[model samples]
Target: MSSAAIFVNIFALSCLVISLIKDRAKTKQSLLVAVKSFFRILPIVLIIIIFIGLLLGFVPLDLISKTMGEQAGFGGVILIASVGAILHIPALIAFPLAASLLKGGASVAAVAAFITTLTMIGTVTLPLEIKELGKKMALLRNGVSFIFAIIIALIMGMML
Candidate 1:
């Protein structure tokens, strides 16, 4: 297992033991609630992973790299930033995709733009965000994220 997995296991066990000692009567209920939440979200997480795997399997990374690798000044940056805006993959998928693109010769700018936008800007989650934070806030947040993603991408391209 990964170090993260080991850490999580240790943390969980420690929490369980601590809870049992501190409040034996509440331990079972706490565990049950945790399990319930996990199960509730498991399906959504599984679906996203499956979708990401499929996208990686089908899409040609070589093509992406060739297209986005161009350092055609601002045009390439715009292309990458726009593509990142369109692709709504989650963080888990974005990291792997960015790694693959990097390996396939994609520029640092493209990978950085893709990663930033993938997490900060989301069309799929926009509706929910709009409902929770109001339309104006949601719009402003996405707009700012979009601009900052490009800026970050450009910075990485220059720095790295």
Candidate 2:
């Protein structure tokens, strides 16, 4: 295992032990809550994993590379960014998907664009945003976010 992973595990255990020592009942309660949350999220995690597996299994590597690799350039980045903006998935789940894309030959820029846009803009929640913040504000925010997302991805591409 990686030293980083080992360190994280040790740190977590240490924290849990400390919590237990400080307040046994509270620690037990916290553990129960954490376990319940884990179970609640387990289905979503499994579904995403299966979806990713299917994506990698069915989609050709060449296609993914061609669409998001170095060859695709700015246009490809923009395309992925748009998709990201439209997707409603949680960022925690998206990280694994992004990692898989990276391993599958997606360009750094495309992946960056995807993640930045995904987190920054939310088309799925736009209706709520509009209702809460007004239409003009929501639209302006999304438009500006889209532009910045593209810029961020391009910069990452250049640096990496």
Candidate 3:
């Protein structure tokens, strides 16, 4: 779990225990609600993570490195961003992958674009986002993120 999550859990449990001492009935009801929500969301999140892992497994690292190497230029950046759009990679996996790509001679622009787009935008989870946030908001956010990735790639190319 993330530090934020751990901290929240500790804080919440402390509050719950305090509440239990003050009002057992209300605390029991609140705990039931919290437990129910956790159960409902945990399985979905786990399944998505597993699916992303499987998707990542299908794409060979050598292939990505070769296709997005410095010689590929802006084409490499676009390609990497496209791949990021298709895969819902977690930050933990994405960072190490980026480092590996860098070591394999992938362009800095391509890797930067891939990492930014992978984290900021999520076409793989777009449907769920649209459902939760409305289609327009999801599209706008994703479109902005995609465009920004390209702009960042260009700047990185110029700088590095």
In order, what lDDT does every prediction score? 0.80, 0.94, 0.81
TM-score of each: 0.64, 0.83, 0.59
The CA lDDT at 31 in model 3 is 83
After superposition, candidate 3 runs with Cα above 4 Å error: 1-66
User: How well is each residue in 59-148 modelled by candidate 2, as lDDT tens digits?
Assistant: 998899999999998899999999999998888889889988988889999999999999999988999999999999999999999999
Pick out the ten consecutive residues of candidate 3 with the lowest summed lDDT: 47-56
What's the distance in Å from true for residue 71, model 1? Answer: 3.1
**Residue 147 CA error for candidate 1 (Å)?**
0.7
**lDDT digits (tens) for residues 1-160 of candidate 1:** 9998899999999999999999987999998999998887677677766765775678786665667775445666677777777787556656756776777667888888878887888888899999999999999999999999999998999899
lDDT leader:
2
Ranking of candidates on lDDT, top first: 2, 3, 1
**TM-score-sorted candidate list, best first:** 2, 1, 3
Total backbone collisions, model 3? 0
Off by over 4 Å in 2: 10-30
Clashes of each: 0, 0, 0
